[model samples]
Target: MSAPERIPPRGVTTDEPLAGLLTHGELTVRGRIREASNAALYCTVAHEGREAACVYKPVAGERPLWDFPDGNLARREVAAYEVSEATGWGLVPPTVLREGPYGEGMVQLWIEVTTEGDTAELLALVDGEEPEPGWKAIGFADVGDDRTALLVHADDERLRRLAVLDAVINNADRKGGHLLPTAEGRLYGIDHGVTFNTENKLRTLLWGWAGEPLTPEALEVLKGLQDALGAEGALAGRLSALITGAELDATRARVAVLLETGRHPEPSGEWPAIPWPPV
Candidate 1:
């Protein structure tokens, strides 16, 4: 598949001004993105001479999950974005639920990241001993010939914020491919259809900072989320429209635990701690 087009700077392409356009705009499917298990299509959204590239996930295309109810994955995607925005992290790209050709679904502004070659280069090691600076090793694999390959991720603040976000939301799928780094040096996460489950199912590839103490800034963000999830808060009202009451309560409880402990969580060992195909 061809790479997605590079997105313009946020200053020139803010999602707020185009919110109405994205919700009510005319959608034309450009092509299908086969990498996703669901029916995800690349489409152009146009209204009143303005246009933007967006990924459309029709509800009919969602695969039924044994845990999560069917037909709600699209809403879950939008809920994740809502949480990200509420925290002021901007970790998730702007997403909304709207009508499309197939049916009602979630549509998110497309974010372009560095090419696969660039990602490979970032994860490559030099001298087989030290990784490129600003990267930290998390795991290793035996590549035969007595050689061991190290798994590492960028030592970036944005990624750290995302780690906390995942913890608060109970994200069940955070594959390495979900972490997209744009040319503008910003990191955005995608594919959040399996999040906010009442059961603790936080599978992810972001365990590099596991067991570390949460920074003061991260704690403040958690505090903000806790407040937003209060009974009378707007965020709580928004989430109620998407997920069950028990699930929303579980989300609040997770944030409360994080605030009380002020530490990144350790794997529970009850389930696989990491996603399949870490990268």
Candidate 2:
């Protein structure tokens, strides 16, 4: 375990370069992200003078979840990445499911967050009747000692795309901390191991645009996703190796519903709408 190698950061929007690097680069572990429920290792990937920091979550360190009975959270993480790439949103970092030091795992480029722009403070809890302009209300949250506060998230386009993506993947845990804002003013969402469930487990704090009409950009993206998720499409083929058939079908269904309704999703009364510790 030593200091991570530093190299010029690659633009997240230019994903192909980073994807190739993560897919074929040499990996070296630096440390473990102990806060992660699973075995998430902080590492570096380097190839031909191009070096970048990244994270490696090996399958051997996976912790079983009663609901996610498949026991392959690593694959789901990669599956989420594939779906994100299809949307052309790049909400996810460049991630590849490859062999690593311990075993096969999801390797993703590390995101460096800088407080250099407006995208910095996207989520907040306010003591007001409603969220101020440029912010959207998620719901009321219990503060403490019989107190309540209005929880809200920024009304940024990046977050709007993420909300749609979360609905598509049935993300079960989209906590506030999972949103990574870069100095480039770009946003990325991580920790998708519990996503793509066959059920409506879309839990997150980004429910600000619930029931609103889907943006035209999002509609176009969904159209692309619909085509790519078909029986013999490329996206389907890529996801087949990462997720189960039922889950894939569920993903298709979600897209169809979005296209049909032309709106954002609302919470299903069956599951918790917001995750615990909302942030």
Judge candidate 2 at residue 202 and give its lDDT: 92
- Give the CA lDDT, 0 to 100, for residue 264 in model 1: 89
Poorly placed runs, candidate 2 (over 4 Å): 1-7, 10-15, 117-120
TM for every model, in the order presented, reads: 0.89, 0.94
lDDT of 1 by residue, 183-222 (tens): 7776788999999898999997677778889999999988
lDDT winner among the candidates? 2
Best-fitting candidate, scored by TM-score = 2
The residue ranges of model 1 lying beyond 4 angstroms of the native Cα positions read 1-15, 115-117, 120-133, 142-147
Q: For each of the candidates, give the backbone clash count.
A: 0, 0
| lDDT (Cα atoms) of all candidates against the true structure | 0.82, 0.88
Q: In model 1, how large is the Cα lDDT of residue 135? A: 79
Each model's Cα RMSD: 4.1, 2.6
